[model samples]
Target: MIKVVSKIMINSSAKQVWNVISEIQRDPYFWKGMSRVRTTSKNGNALTRQVTLANSEKCLQKVILFPIEGIHIRWTRGMITGTKDIMITQIGTQTLLEVEMNYELHGIAQVRSRSISEELRDEAELAVHLVKEEIEKTQAFPTESRKQWADMIHE
Candidate 1:
């Protein structure tokens, strides 16, 4: 399996970062090359979405969210079969966001594994950067977001 990791430090609380990342619906905005995300199903904390890549290829992804800690999105179909994890770490008032994507290429993609791996790395970096920008741009911590995390933590 090829692993691509990206990390970033944002000037915000982990809860603030968690709110933006855990929304799931806003994924395409942060995940570069991803054209769209359509929720297909939801069961408990796990959500299944149809993801459309920039190349117009479609894939199914199962997203499992873990409160303020992390989110695990596993590509269940198409040319990718792997998991992408988004982890949040709290450091004082700053939040450290890290994303790791582990996947094995299939068919023709396996032949171009090196290039695809490089693209994944770049995508991961951009994902975190966009997330950082979104949270920092708003600055204000939405009470609904805070309460949402609070409710999940208590559950």
Candidate 2:
């Protein structure tokens, strides 16, 4: 088994960040290599989306959503691909996003000289970077009234 973890700090609130990540079905452009994303099931945050890569390669992925925390997804085009866990936490006034992925290579080594573990780590890092960039581009949420009110001190 191989494990890859990446983290990024974004100048945004956790709720604001969650809004973008939670809308996986609505925004296909946020994905790195995906050209198109079709939702198989969309019942709130938990969804099944079919992603088509630029090279026309397609894969079905299971997307699970978490409040202001993060999103989790699993995909397997072939062999034992892996699952990605994206966790979001509030650090000071910014949001910290962390991603972790685990995968295992299958079949014989002679046939496939390339290391799937290394590839998985690189891909996971790239994916997290893309997600951070996408979240940074969002200007939708400026501030939440709930958060603002909670931050105030009554005299």
* lDDT (C-alpha, whole model) for all candidates: 0.90, 0.72
Candidate with the greatest TM-score versus the true structure: 1
Per-residue alpha-carbon lDDT of model 1 for 3-101, expressed as tens digits? 998999999999999999988887888887789999999999998999998878898999999999999989999888899999999999898999988
Q: Candidate 2 lDDT, tens digit per residue, 1-155?
A: 67878888888889988887776764445545567888888787688878876547677788888899888888765344568788999998899888887655455522452565665566667766777777777656567556456467662
lDDT of 2 at 117: 60
Candidate whose lDDT is highest: 1
Q: Which 10 consecutive positions of candidate 1 have the poorest summed lDDT? A: 140-149
For candidate 1, the TM-score is 0.86
